[model samples]
Target: MATEAKKSGGIVETIKTVVYALLIAGIFRSLFFQPFWIPSGSMKDTLLIGDFLFVNKMTYGYSYASCPSIRIASLGINIDAKDICGIFDGDNKRLFGSEPERGDVVVFRHPVTGYDFIKRLIGLPGDRVQLKDGVVFINDEPVQLEDAGVFEEAAGPQGPQGLRPRCENGPVGDGGLCVKSRKIETLPGGVSHSILNISEQATDNTGIYTVPEGHFFFLGDNRDNSTDSRVPQAARGVGFVPYENLIGRADRIMFSSAGRSMFAFWTWRSDRYFKAIE
Candidate 1:
């Protein structure tokens, strides 16, 4: 009888140990490094639909659904199950001191549907941003373009696709798609990054927009195909993203896959893994 009691006690202890280990891992994954999957081509060339990315949660701070930001005490504190559940249940708000900078690629909760999107910052507070003739202008200066030649074609299980074509003829006069060269342009704050041009004609162009305080203007790398701040807020597009909506800056591309096919697993491009985002 004594031996049986000892054996039962040992089994219970082992179970507790396993449970605690899993809890710690889950907390780390959620608060430090969370995995995100790309689901659209809005950020194409820079990001793809089948790409798997690791979003550094600590880059900003603890985001609690839709409520304002809060302090995270430690990694293993099991204090608020309500807060964890609130991620999908409540509103989104940012913690204090969580500000985004110009040229940071950020993932944020879309103001319209509360869905998440990753986009590049173009205009900051009190800056005048406009899109004229398919070129982005900040503070009345045209964004400089540097031709990078053709991007390497990406291959998938189904077949292969060419790089995002460049647009050189300015915006099309008739509102059709045009591909031109890609280039890196410096913003007013000396923040430089690459952008794609599709023809010289501007379609969803906007006039001088003084980005209001506590808001930001974002545009997709795939400028012509993206529905971003250029569209009015009433049209279900982002007019300006509040600081609270920001999740974190996209630090790097963890991995990438090609094609728009459903079976993306077999099409993974092993060479693209861990490529740093430029």
Candidate 2:
């Protein structure tokens, strides 16, 4: 009976250790640091598809606290479910001394699908954003662009292995559509980044949009390829983004992989590591 009691005690200790380890990891991932995988080329040339990144959760204050899971009502009607989940035993307020700044790369929950998306903050609250003939303008000041040349041809399976090339690049039909690479010209107020223009003509044309109060205007670095605020209202195109939906700020690229190949972990581009976001 003595031996059996000792064995049971050891087993409980092991279980407690495992639970503590998992809880620590969960807290770190949800609050301070979280890993994100780039699933699309929408931010190409800056952030490639398959680029695994680490977003700094502390950059814009803790969003999970400010925006707790509360069921929102329409006008005066009560809703059944909450759209967001609050942190357990955590204060629902912005305690950290941080705020979203213009030109910062940010991650946020997509208003339409509730999925997370990463984009650069181009226009802040009450700022006017416009695009004309492929040129972006903020408050009537034109955003600059420079020629960065083309991408080097890399040989590989033309499409995902053993799959028909549906719609060109992938099943979503945006594969290889916009391949042109260009250097981004720095805009006024210290905003600068690269952009990819697939076609010579500006496909996304939108009139002046004044960012609403407590909202932001986001745009993908791959301007021509991204479905940003410039799209039509029916497709959930470019518009104001609520502040509560922000997840965090993207600070650095942790690792990058070529194409959609997962097993080719050895083929990760090591030269791009520790590079700062522009």
Candidate 3:
């Protein structure tokens, strides 16, 4: 027949141009943008552990887990695309965006393991927060550190080879996960971040947290190894994060890797691709 009907009409027009290019790339990643990956270092050196950012889902208004996976998981919608359009069913707000100051760097939907994490936005909904001995008071003032020094690392209990919550990576136990420390804060709008402390653990002397009403008080510029919100969602940490689990504002990075396999293309990191998440 006419050359097998012209190869079956060029295979049905190449499967309808790949289903119309996957529905225009799923409506351009569910409207506006979203691409995150920095497996974990808890925002180290401002985000490293193989950084790879983008998130800016209209800057703050798109929830329904605003594209983390955009939900549908067997009806539970796990993996950070949390509560799918129901926004946890109480109308958790944030439908038009804006409001998330302090130091920014966020990426949420993790009100207690909904899973997108990524911190930095210290207290805002009623402030009063504290840390005293390790410094970081708000509403009472102390929010301006200096000593930008040590922050070394390398003594694995599993990290750097893939970097993750791997045993919570700290100068923890068995003498292997090395880390040195010092100050480097500066958030009152000026930004200036950096913090580590290999010494005074246990959330570095907390106690006086207030911050309620709409909730939000994150942290994890690696201050003594983060669990966030001063660790307390029944102890799994990252508590007090509502405002409907706000999920955006990571700004830029776009690519990096020390490769434990993201195809391992020569362990990438190529000058940290398009850097700029500060």
Candidate 4:
């Protein structure tokens, strides 16, 4: 009888330990860092579809967007950030917030859909932004762009979504090489990064967009492929993201996998582990 009682007590202690550990991890994830997985190729060579990184939440301080949204379809658990931190929503302010710099790679909540979108910050508050001939123009001046050869990848399906790449030289066959023109873009304030050009598209040229006060403009590095601030939110685009919607900045990639599952050890991209985001 005593042995049975001891076994039961030990099981209860183990359960308590696990519960406590999970609670601590949840708090840490909500307050400090939020793990983000690149699910699309909008950022392209800068951030691949399988790249996994931690967004530094502390960099932009706390907001309602800081709360984690947990959704497990199979388990039937759905929780939104607004559900958890709805009390903190509205007023368009963050608790200890600092303005994000232009050219910073940021992940923020979509102003309309509440989905998370990652893009390069382009225009800050009260700045004029536009795109002409595939080059970004900020404050009515074109950003410097230097040719950087071609970015090549397989024409086959990529990542778990099985999405195919859009090539500058396409109708590429299944296993053929897909290519895009690469350029090194130098933003104002001396921040430089790689940008890919697929082909001429409507977003390549735009009317002057004056960023509103307390809002920002963003763009994807994959010039023609991304649906960013250039389009209006009503048309399913992320237009003029609010300051309070900013979640965090993704500074570096922590891990990367080319396969459908991250657990597939052989499919891991060894070169991208712990790579600092440029």
Candidate 5:
């Protein structure tokens, strides 16, 4: 009887340890840094699919969007940040918030869908932004772009999503080289980054979009492939994201994998480990 009682107490203690660990992890994720996995090529050479980074939550302070959204399909555990922290939402204000600078890579919640999206901040509130012939213009001044050669990757399926990359030199067979034109885009205030181009698309040329006050305009580095501020939310694009929807800034990549599973040691991208995000 005593042996059974000891075993029961041990089990209870183990359960308590697990619960405490979970609570600590939850608090850590909610307040300081949130893990973000790059699932798409929208950011391209700047941030490839399978790049894992921690969003610096404190950079923009706290808001309802800063709360982590947990989704485990296998476990059927789907929890949105709104479900946990919705009580703190609706004001469109952030606590101890700081303004995000242009050219900074950010992760924010989609205003309508509540899903997270990462993009480079291209336009601030009240900025006039436009794209003409695949070039970005801020307040009618064209941004500086210099050809940076071409970016190439395998034509086969990439990452866990098995998504094929759209290439400028397409019609590539599996295991062949998929290529896109690369350029060094220098935004206003001297922030420069790499941008990829496949070809001229409808989004390449657009009328001036006057970003409304209290909202920001963002665009992906992969200009031709992104569905960003150029398209409206109604059209399934991430329209001018609200200030409160901003979650955090992504500073550096923590880990990266090119395979279907992160645990595939052979597929780990050693060069990308602890790499800084530009």
Candidate 6:
């Protein structure tokens, strides 16, 4: 009987240890980092579908966008689950960290949908932004662009079918899409990143837009395919994302897979493992 009791106590202790470990891991994930996997080709070429990565939670410090009031944060509560941002409703000064820089890949809450969306930061508060003939113009002058050649991609089971920005012209392999004209765009501070150019797309041109204070403008790397700041929120576009909506920057790709299931070891993208998001 005593041996059975001892065994039961050990099992209870093991369960408690696991529960404590999970709680600690939850706190670490909430405070230090956030793991996410790319589900769409929106940030493609830079972050492909199935690319798993971590967002530094502290990168922008504690903000209403991150959690509930700093008060609850101190109480060890989950901010996002509590809908603190929606309840408080306003701009929040970052408790720490720096502002988003040009050409940064940022993760943020979609203003209208509340869904987590990732895009490249383009215009800062008060910066003039425009797109003309498939080129991005900031402060009246076009951001520099140079030809970078083709970017090809195979469609995933989850990806939309047929020709898209990632697979612009036509078939690549058995069923892949390829873009023959990709351009490397250099931001003002010399931050360079590649952008796709589909001259036929309507978003390729736009009137000059002055970014409002306390907000930032964003664009997708797959320029012609993304519905970002250029689109209105009512129509499912992000529009001008408020400062409070800022989440964190994605720093690296932890892993990637090309298959439908994440556990499919045969579909692991070996080349993209541990790749940096540039």
lDDT of 4 by residue, 95-187 (tens): 989889999999999998888899999999999999889888888899999999999988988888888899999779899999999999999
What TM-score, to 2 decimals, does candidate 3 have? 0.36
**Pairs with backbone N, CA or C atoms under 3 Å apart (clashes), candidate 5:** none
**Tens digits of per-residue lDDT for model 1 on 1-278?**
99999999999999999999978867776566656667765665677666778766666665553232233456654443235545543344455436677777778767766667788898888888988777788888888766765433323222233334334554333234544456676766677666665544455466877888878999988777687888768987888987666666777777666655435656677777886665
Point out the higher-scoring one by lDDT: 2 or 3. 3
TM-score, every prediction: 0.70, 0.78, 0.36, 0.97, 0.98, 0.85
Candidate 3 per-residue C-alpha lDDT over 75-144 given as tens digits, one digit per residue, 9 for 90 to 100: 8854445434554435667668678888888888677557777888889998888897788889889888
Per-candidate Cα lDDT values, in order, are: 0.66, 0.66, 0.73, 0.93, 0.93, 0.77
Deviation in Å, model 3, residue 54 alpha carbon: 14
Worst 10 residues of 2 by lDDT: 159-168
Weakest lDDT window of 10 consecutive positions for candidate 3: 162-171
RMSD of each: 7.8, 6.9, 14.5, 1.2, 0.9, 5.1
| lDDT, candidate 6, 1-278, per-residue tens | 99999999999999999999988976776678877778777776788777889988787775656652222455685435237445545644666757888888998888876678999999999999999888889999899999888776654355223223345665445556655467888999999888875547788888887999888999998787788999878888999988777778899998887776567768888898889998
- What is the lDDT, from 0 to 100, of the residue 46 in candidate 6? 84
* CA error at residue 33 for candidate 2, angstroms: 1.1
If both were scored by TM-score, which would come out higher, candidate 4 or candidate 6? 4
> Of the pair 1 and 5, which is ahead by TM-score?
5
Candidate closest to the true structure, highest TM-score: 5
- Backbone Cα, N, C clashes tallied per candidate: 19, 2, 1, 0, 0, 1
Question: Model 5 over residues 169-233: C-alpha lDDT tens digits?
Answer: 96788999999999999999999999999988899999999999889999999999887999999
Candidate 2: what lDDT? 0.66
Ranking by TM-score: 5, 4, 6, 2, 1, 3
